[model samples]
Structures are given as C-alpha cells and as structure tokens.
Target: MPLIVFCGIPGSGKTTRALQIKEYLEQKHKCQVVHLNEEILQMEKKEVYKDFQAEKFARGFLRSNVEKNIAGNTVVILDSLNYIKGYRYELFCLARAAQTQHCVIYCECDPQLAKENNSKNANNFTEEMLADYNNRLEIPIPKNRWDSPLFHLRSKEETPFEEIANVLLYQAKKSKDPVSTAPEIKFEINFLQELDLRVQSVIDELVQKQQESIQSNVITFSDCTEKLMINKQISLIELKKIKQEYLKITKHNPPKRIEDIKNFFIIYLQKVVERF
Candidate 1:
C-alpha cells in the first residue's frame, strides 16, 4: 500500500504533478493508482472552493476512499491542498494502521506566479482566499514522520518519475523484513460505544420492518428466524470487541444490502466463538 499525498496551494501545479506520477506508476511499474481528487470532485454537487463545509465534506469523502484503497495493494494519490499538518498526521496514522507506505510531495511555487496561473482557471481561488490559505499553510518538514520521504518540486518542473517509483516500490519492499507482524488496531472507547449504538439502530430498524411485513402477511415468521440470529447472538461486550476489528476492515467499505449486514454479524459471532 502506497499513498502519495500532494501538498500545495491552488495553482501550484499539484494536480498536474499528481497525474504525471499516476501515469508513470501505472505505465512503468504496473501499479494501480486511485486518483482521489477526481473522485471527490465528481461526488461534489456544487463548487467547493471557499466553502468550509463543502471542503470538509470532500476531505472526509477522500479520507474514506483512501482508507478503502490503502487496505489493498494499490497506490493512492491524494491530490489536494493538504495545507494542514494535522490532517497530514491523521493520514499518516491511517497508513500506519493499515501497514502501508506513504510519502508527501510538496509543490513549491512563487506566490505571485501562482496567482497569475490561478487567474486563467474558471474555478480559480480569489486573491483574498489565496492569501488566507498561504498565511495558514503549514509546510511539511522532512523530519516529521507524517511528511518523511518528502519530494519537493518546482511548480513547472518535470516530475522525477524514476525516483518516486523507486521510493514507493523498491524502497518500500526493502523495508519490509522477513518477520511478518500485524498492524495494531485501536479505537476510542466512545467510538466503540457509538458503533454499538449504530448496530443496535440497524437491528431495531430491520426488526420493526420485519414485524410490519409479517403482520401484513407479506412474509412468514420462518423466513426471518435465521435473519434474527444477529439479535440473539450479539452481546454488548463481545460486540464492542468484535466491532473494533469489524470496523477496521469495513468502516470505509460497509455492506450494501441488509442480508450482507446480517451475514457480517453472523460471521463476527462465529469468529468470536472460534477464538475461545
């Protein structure tokens, strides 16, 4: 799992560099790259620039997608301003949790030239907004674990494809020793409580719906006996523990169907019992 994060102000050619790297990795290294920026933009119904809530939503969406991708053997290019060091640290923690390799690419550009470039785009940032972001920008430092393996590039310079590929591919491979160790999964106590509530909510909804359908004679009781197994087998304490592991794999990739959710619960119960 390789996550390449792009950090730069608007009009700093971050997207261009990200795309070039994506193409090089896909073509040369035969690596799968998920361009998260494109996906986020596609999901947006309105303009996100200058809108705090929209930007926050987009970032959350991007994070979920990145989480889902990093769980697999693929490269994820996070094409965004990434001006916040705290956010970068969060991503660094996620990569660590997923046992993936990650790096940061900072596209350094002249402020005046960047504004000039921004003027050419229809969705360009306003001068005030650009200045605000610049003032708040927390440049990544090489010494930071979240920003290590950082690659600095000029706005218009060609991306060093070979160097980037080597860092992500060969260097990452070399770092992985023979002894296989599992990544430690942790969750906040309140978050586990919240997940339990969510699971209970889903169970409650399904049970109510099943009762309604049964009363209408649309379905018989026998049809739901196996489905109700989740309610019977799920213990709050056991659920809290299993849910920690369950969410590690599924928080970003939730089940789409009710049956699948029930199956997941059943499978979780089986695994818990098997451990004892």
Candidate 2:
C-alpha cells in the first residue's frame, strides 16, 4: 500500500531517485514493485501531460492507474512532475478514497544541473517549459492533510540513494507487512507519521499549500470495476472476492478518513490470508 510520488522538474533527478527507490524496494524488501514511469506511461501506453488536453487526460488516467496498482502486491512508485499543487492534492484525495498508504519524495537539484540533464536527454522537454516550471514552482511546505513525507536531497554530486533508502526502510518497517522485503516498512510508518505532524504544525498549511485551483476530477469505483472487467486483469472469482470481502470488512460503513483506510486494508489482507 505504499504509493511513492516523485515531484521535480524535467531534469531534477526525479526519475533517477524513483529508479533508485524501485531498485531498493525490490531488492531489499523482496516485494513486488511497479515503476509507474516505466509501466503506466511507457509500457502501459498511456499519454502524458504536455498541454491542457494532454495533461488533463493523463492526470485522470494516472490517478486511476495508481489506485488500481495499489490493489495488487506491487507497491507503485509514480514518477512525474506532479507540479500542479491542486493536482497533488487530488492525488492525496484519491489515495485516501482508496484507503492506500502513501509517501511523497520531493527531488530538488541545482537549476544548472537540471538544465544540463534536460539538454542531454533526447526526449527532454523544452527549455521554456523547464524555465517556467522553475520560475513558478511552489515548494511544498509540510501539510497534514496530504500526509506528505518529504526528503530534500541537496547534493549536486549524487542523490544519496543510501540516505533515501534509510528513510524508505524506516517507513517499510512501520508498514510491517511481514512479507514486505522493505527493510523499514514498520519504520516508514513512524517516519511518515512524523512528516504528517510537521505538515500539520504549520498554521493554515492547507491554504498556504492548497492545490485548489483545479476543477474536481474523480473516477468512480464503478469506473474501476468496468476497467477491470474490460481489461480482464483479475479473474471473475478474484473480483467477487474483492467485493464480498471488501463489503464484509467495510461492514457497509465506508471509510471517512485516511486513517480508517488502514483497517479497510487490514481486512482485505486478512481475507486473502484466509483464502490461502
């Protein structure tokens, strides 16, 4: 249930960090992992944000895809600019609605380095766009509602993958998924809790950091069901189990808050264990 979102400009080492996290999570935790950049975009053949139409289309699709992936064994790591504040908030809402646990890793690099990396990449974005992003980018001040766990990597030398690994390992410890190979699933829970607290500490953090400019965009659970059926990703039996077991666990009393989501998942996992 770990949804790790990376936000940075085109050449800010977001993809690099994301790959590092993916490698560590898979190698250290032995948990099934999915790289959203590779899977959701390149492999899944999904469109990405470029203009208004493309960005809207991709954002909607990305949100749904992230939620779906969380229902599986793989912990999904989403790599994107996620530059828009409201868009980031929407992600928070989606994860909460799905009862999935999440963390945010903000990758920041020197503008010089960012520009250099952008120029080096064959498919790198336009300089104008990168310049605009850097100009207008509002760094996320800690906020409770988002439950964002931030790691500021400042080294121009390298991304301190080892330090980031320590933080992830801690969070994994807190997750305490017995089968999770992540070194600190249980510890991450603590780290995340602390991060959330820091976000809450700032008064009017919501307004100060709110991503409210965007319109409401939501994909219903019904939509998810349709997609699953059409795609045939899960068996009919598994679908039935998800419904029956989710209903049994939720007790018709749906989750109202992010924390309640933990119980919903615990129930889901319990059902899986029982079946085996």
Cα-based lDDT for every prediction: 0.68, 0.55
lDDT of 1 by residue, 85-194 (tens): 75676677677666567899999999998899878766577898788888878899897667888998997677888988888888777655433573333544455455
Give each model a TM-score: 0.62, 0.56
TM-score of 1: 0.62
Residues 1-276, candidate 2: write the lDDT tens digits. Answer: 567777777788877777777787778767677787634465222234355556556666666688788766677888877765545655665554444566667777788889998787665767777887788675654553453666565535565555655544465556544434534223333444543332232212222322333232321121011100011123445544554544443332244444434433333332232233
Clashing pairs in 1: none
Q: Which regions of candidate 1 fall more than 4 Å away from where they truly are? A: 38-40, 43-46, 177-276
